[model samples]
Target: MASGVDLVIFGATGDLSRRKILPSLGALVARERTKLRVIGAGRSHDTTDQFRELVKEASGNPALAATAEWVTLDYADPASFAPINALITGTAVVIFYLATPPETFSPILVAIANSAMVTKGDPSRRVVLEKPLGYDRKSAKELNAQLATAFDESQVYRIDHYLAKDTVQNVLAFRFSNSLFEPVWNRNLVETIQITVAEEEGIRQRAGYYDQTGAVRDIFQNHVLQLLALVTMEPPTTFDPDYVRRAKRAALRAMSPLDVTSAVRGQYEGYLDEPGVSLESRRETYAAARVSIENWRWDGVPIFVRTGKALRRRATEVVIKLRDAPLDR
Candidate 1:
């Protein structure tokens, strides 16, 4: 929200950057009329001018491109971060957004901590990490420890972009604000809740990342779970982000562990032949599971969640089926 904010996006040329980050930043600049310095950081050897062209093309906003610059960054090399540090002024708010894979997070954070950009206890300096945070519970803990070394919990943000979607945010408003729905949102009136996130496109350029991270890790862990939490969470006392997050966490804690035996996993036909996919890979492109929250409000209600790639249609929806009214006597 500040005037002189420096936004350094790692993996600037990656799919996520091209598809989401750059475009969103461009729109933000256009909408807020804020003075933002965009630094596109990647391992690519592209010059500043070349990177600006890429930003212009991806964001479709020349004004965003005009404020953009590029810096070569190597997660393993501390010296690579020097260029990034030099670009930052003493008083500017610095935001480091990691758009790279989870494995690279540790080294990148260490490199950032060693640089002059991050001043300890400075809230103005922040880091944003995109999920899936890690492969599993143990790895996630390790990642948290790594993050702790570089930033305070307050300064570190683990983001699931799905939560930023208007429809998804509206779920909270629809449940809490609508008297018609809020009264009947519990298990007594709601029979079941089904969340489905389907994608029509196959793993096009992300075969390498997709194969390593299947449907469960890629979608179910972050996006699907966040949706489930939003739907099942109790109304927070306040609209503050921390309170909302606590409500979501409470809902997640009440949910039963997924029953592995009842889970379904499958791969799309011809998936094995996709580039970077192993011939014998057992990675699933589709996954579905039955979830239950053992809480007063949601008890006896079944929550079904599923996500997939190369599906019949591309849709993300939450359907709540209510109990039928008694027949007329």
Candidate 2:
């Protein structure tokens, strides 16, 4: 790790990297905080020049385009990982942004560990993993265990973008910092919490991928579950990492084991009938569920989650129904 910091985007040419990442990074650089050097790595067979052009065009900023550096690096190749390490030598912070599918994580992790990219002696070396951590609870535990072997819990940052929202952050600050909300934050004070991320667009070109994941694995498993924990977890005794993590883990454990009856899974007729979709795919397009937490703070309150593809509107927001309202009298 170098003194400052450099961010290496593993799937730099992908949809997420180009649309959200490069633009945001550009904004940071434009603000004169270029201490963070960004290296674009992906499976795209493009040369450095082509990838740079792709980022600039996708980022939609001429200045950012000119400043970007592109490198053709396969995440699974240890030899390719060397350049990213070389670019940010000397006490610099290294953040590997994995913008690829969850299935690619293990291979990439192994390659980085073997390439000297993740310095065991360096305190600032970091890795960021995206959502869809696993297809289910069993797989999630396996993934977590594998990550733990190479990087300490503190070194791994599991990124759930939903938590980055202004409202979600405010939820924690409001409940803990103010005496006004803390007393009434529990089940006795809150009725029920519902988190919904609705989408109107059908599977479209995502049919192949979505067919395997469905709504549960795609959104609810990681995204909505994160929101549920944030809204319902007990306040950390302190801001220390262990305390905060314990509180969240407790909330997750408090959730009653999911049952098929408590949840509903659906698929749209027209979506599978679309030009590219198969008639026999078992993937669910829509899923909704009411989950209960078995803790004192939220014993009876139900947390509801539902998400779907190919229909309706495109909106994502959380709704918290507070139980302690003042009487009109």
lDDT (C-alpha, whole model) for all candidates: 0.90, 0.76
RMSD, one per candidate, in order: 2.1, 3.5
- Regions of candidate 1 where Cα sits further than 4 Å from its true position: 1-3
Best by TM-score: 1
Residue 122 error for model 1, in Å? 1.0
Assess every candidate by TM-score: 0.95, 0.83
Q: Backbone collision count in every prediction?
A: 0, 10
Error of 1 at 119 (Å): 1.2
Show where candidate 2 strays beyond 4 Å.
Answer: 1-4, 60-63, 73-76, 80-91, 177-182, 202-209, 268-270, 273-279, 322-329
lDDT, candidate 2, at 299:
88
For candidate 2, list the clashing residue pairs, or say none. 1-91, 1-92, 2-90, 2-91, 2-92, 3-91, 3-92, 200-311, 201-310, 202-310
For candidate 1, write residues 101-207 as lDDT tens digits: 87788888889988767866789999999998989999999999987877888898898888899989899889999999999999999989999999999998887
- Largest lDDT belongs to which candidate? 1
Instruction: Report the C-alpha displacement of residue 126, candidate 1, in angstroms.
Output: 1.0
